[model samples]
Target: MSSSPIATVKRELLVRHLEAWAPAALHRARRVIYAHGYADADGGVSAEAAMRVLAEQSDLVRGRELIMVATGDDLGAIDPRLKTISAESGAGAGLAVHTISGGTDGRLPVGLKAVGAQRVPVLGFLDASGSEPPAPATVAALTAGKPSEMLLVLPPGSSASSVDAYRAGWPLFTQVELADSEEPGELLVYATTAGKSLEGFKEALWSVDEFAGVRYRDPGDPERHLIDISLTPHPGPLRRELLAHLAQAGEATVTELRTFALTETVYRAADATRVLHTLVDAGTVTRRPSHGRLGGDVVISA
Candidate 1:
């Protein structure tokens, strides 16, 4: 698709402003930390994803440090023990941690506390779902006696009016827009920082190639940085197609199946084989008993 002229102008403006703004923003805090309240259900965001975002931001705020604290339902759902391990690791890494229950007012659950001891002034809140940005009192408490930056990361279809309410009050903050398009999803990040070259910053945003698409907007009177990109599919469609094909076949030698099903639309034999094995291990499919060739009579059956 052709790029829109407005998008081009916006991109140019964004790079220019961030180059001038990021340095000043980082002047007070030597390190910036990011934390997510929830994962995108369509293609869940994890610490790995957060790290990618932070890495891009790090390039923008050259001298400053970056830390991450990821919270939400998926962590517990994917692996509770792993979640505990990650939290402990965060503390060891000197990162403040908090757990967020999705659909709440963007506040941490009752017993959770915002990370304070690290002297982190700016707290990036990812995936807020409620009507308000956050209570001023809550903001006061979170940033208490410290210079801080608060950015909101929200999904598409979020209430713009609610976001506007917060923007009206906090002009320095930026909003990063994320939309679930395709598999991996894309995020449009808009923010203003001091002493950073907007061009360099915009380039940094594009470094997240794992995402299918990305875009940036400049910081100005209506300072903006917008990123529009699609998410790379995980486990991809080809793998799924291979599994389905195998299920339909009832049972067949790997070589026989590969000859009939392998194509640009399907996974490579190696990947398909791996996926099949995974399904078998998960009990979603059964592997026939065979002690011969790696490409033996491997029957895929439910």
Candidate 2:
């Protein structure tokens, strides 16, 4: 009757990055407004994550706020706790949740003028089930600078077939695809207007054993039908925290580490693995049963 644990797990993965990205983003601007409030049937995980982010980064987000946008008339779909936090947060000021009559049709519920009124970097996110993503204008302002970012969650479908739509929605930002048709029913596609492709995200996952069964691709890459997102991008603090988690848990299989990270921290198995080989090179960790570049048995160094 409920969504699969894997679905929740993956959604949380997105949320953790948002939490991680918040403070760093704030450094570039005086205020930050993070928006997400669509397709939140499973307890509004994204909305809750934003609230948790506000709670976690109290010092940096004093004047900054997290704006959550939800559309449609399905009151039952809305999470009551979001309202509770909103009421207690800033009386609809900071951490305000706005309910609109239409979906995230490529514009903030408050309109671009309202968003520009803040005069700060903006990060917009939408998880839509339909073929239509946020209209280009909804995300246009954020694309001008690298600091501004937009994330789109596409339901399972022909990812490559709709590459045109993704390219159109994101404007100049590189259209980085995060999934394919393999996991048909899973929350299977991610397109981000990020400075770098999620190569690090993919590589980090590849370095772990649990993700061996996972295959992420793009229609345009050398893999043709399956896009190879193999690149070594920096994972930042995610790598540090993941290593700490592994160290605390001791030498374990990749699957074991993945389960630990998923339950205990914001860093997922993939995002945290960006620094795995780096640590092995620096002796922060030692590869046992030496599997070379494949990322086999790992042991934390003393």
Candidate 3:
């Protein structure tokens, strides 16, 4: 069966993130564990994307590995395709693919353990399509004191409590509600400890081309504004968030505010800088080093 438009957008975003993350991850980690929960029969949409990343970064994979594990009730259809990819990618020696035919919630943990992922860096994409969300503990265990991250897809209109439960163990998280031509929409939660990972995720998020009939909503927005998916994203949301942050902080340096945007908000550091400049021109905020261009040391107060 073909995927719906929304599914296509989701998959595109997933591919973009994997492409952006894999290169940096391969540099320090011994293995890249990609665990897919509720995996599609054909190894999910991003498997090829992962292979492409591995192929492109072949030089970086001196002795490192990319282990792709797909878990579902019946993943028989994906095994051969994974083998083909492993062989064709020209990196077979560093590629390992496994298919576990069983419930994802149960099989994912076992699959991850079986592949010896406990000590390595793992990037897990857990989709709760036909099964309940994996226990929060399971997701947390993957990241506890380790250089691991998880991307979660929760059902439309999933309660805020459930979101909180999933975010408990991670020091940082970024969540966006993806709304399409439907009543309610899916929620994507990306949890990680490293600020660099969040930055890469935002880069991946904006890297995708705008798809028709799809919009992204930030749940934290009081107005619940929906943003269009575009290469040059709208900065209105970032403007508001920056002002609010300044209000809370009273005063901060340009460098500090940029860091806030990169880590705490969906906007990039450059986006934050531009918005702050506009605010300065409009007399909305005052800067101490007002004579020259706004450098990192310039202090700004609301």
Candidate 4:
């Protein structure tokens, strides 16, 4: 399967945003290395040409550091060459590899052994005809800023529940939405995990919770639970109802909705209040004094 054109567009927008923000965040680095790789070739525009296109669009890559290019007819089979080019680029190099995978082509070879040594984090694009590649678990692990290690594998035809279990073990990884042709229209959760892969990691993900929800586990201390939440696309119905009730009622004491909303959802009144407060902060709702009640009225609106 491949990614939809819309998904590709969205991912491009996201990449642009990230590129704009990278410099500010990495002000201390002397230069940002931009390493480019391609999975295939197309009419006139060779992989080198594509690299130039990326370099042109990315302000960070404009004469700031070295630009390394690697291309092959098949990316999965040429993992070692990709690593070598990445290593030659320099240490602490920021990589941007573009692989042309249509999805379901088996995992594109992305090993951390070489890139990890450089301590360089990479942003990648797997271009195809459908949706963008889901965020890789390796990226999620890197975000933890911890030295721990773990390997996350998406076995062939693995269920959503299996992915969720892997996520539960690594709480530090944030979820990103991914749409790819391999699963067309199916939502996938992307999280950062350790750069290192441990043997049997894939089996462990399958052995755990059978539910289709994300979980966080710390590699250093596997006993600690970070977060465990469902990866369902739609927001919970109870959450929506509570917001609607708050909108209609203007403002009701937290106690008033405990039985119907809070208790039913297994959320404490404090949590409910926090949600409402966040809404208020975002200007989606407003808080005011209650004229006759013990608590205040929360006016929910756009």
Candidate 3 on 70-185: residue-level lDDT in tens? 77778677667766777777665787778888777678777788888876778888777435777876676567325788888888888889888977768878787788753557
Off by over 4 Å in 3: 41-43, 46-62, 129-131, 181-184
Instruction: Give the number of colliding residue pairs in candidate 4.
Output: 24
Q: What stretches of model 2 exceed 4 Å from their correct place?
A: 37-43, 72-79, 86-94, 106-112, 117-119, 130-146, 159-161, 168-215, 221-302
lDDT of 2 by residue, 1-302 (tens): 12454444445555656666667766666556666635444456656666665555555655665555554324355657666766664424545555553545533545534644255555556666434545555545444434455555566654555534545535223223334345443333333444243433333333422222333433223332332323433344445555666657666665555544433332345544555666666777766656555353454342
Worst 10 residues of 4 by lDDT: 195-204
Worst ten in a row by lDDT for model 3: 41-50
- Give the deviation of candidate 3 from the true structure as CA RMSD: 2.8
Tens-place lDDT per residue, model 4, 129-242, is: 222233545334333323222222232244555455545434423222222222322232333333222111222322333233333321112122223332221223335556
> Which lDDT tens digits does candidate 1 get at residues 1-302?
11333223323333333333334445657755444444433233343334433333443444444444454544445334334544544333333234454533344423224443245544444334322344434433334313333434443444446445444323233333333332222223332232122223334433333333333321111322233422222334434555656667666666555433332221234445666666666777666663443454666564
> lDDT (CA) for every model shown?
0.40, 0.49, 0.76, 0.36
My TM-score estimates for the predictions, one after another, are 0.39, 0.55, 0.86, 0.37
Candidate that scores best on TM-score: 3
**What's the number of clashes in each of the models?**
30, 5, 0, 24
Cα RMSD (Å) per model? Answer: 20.8, 11.7, 2.8, 13.8
- Candidate 2 clash figure, as a count: 5
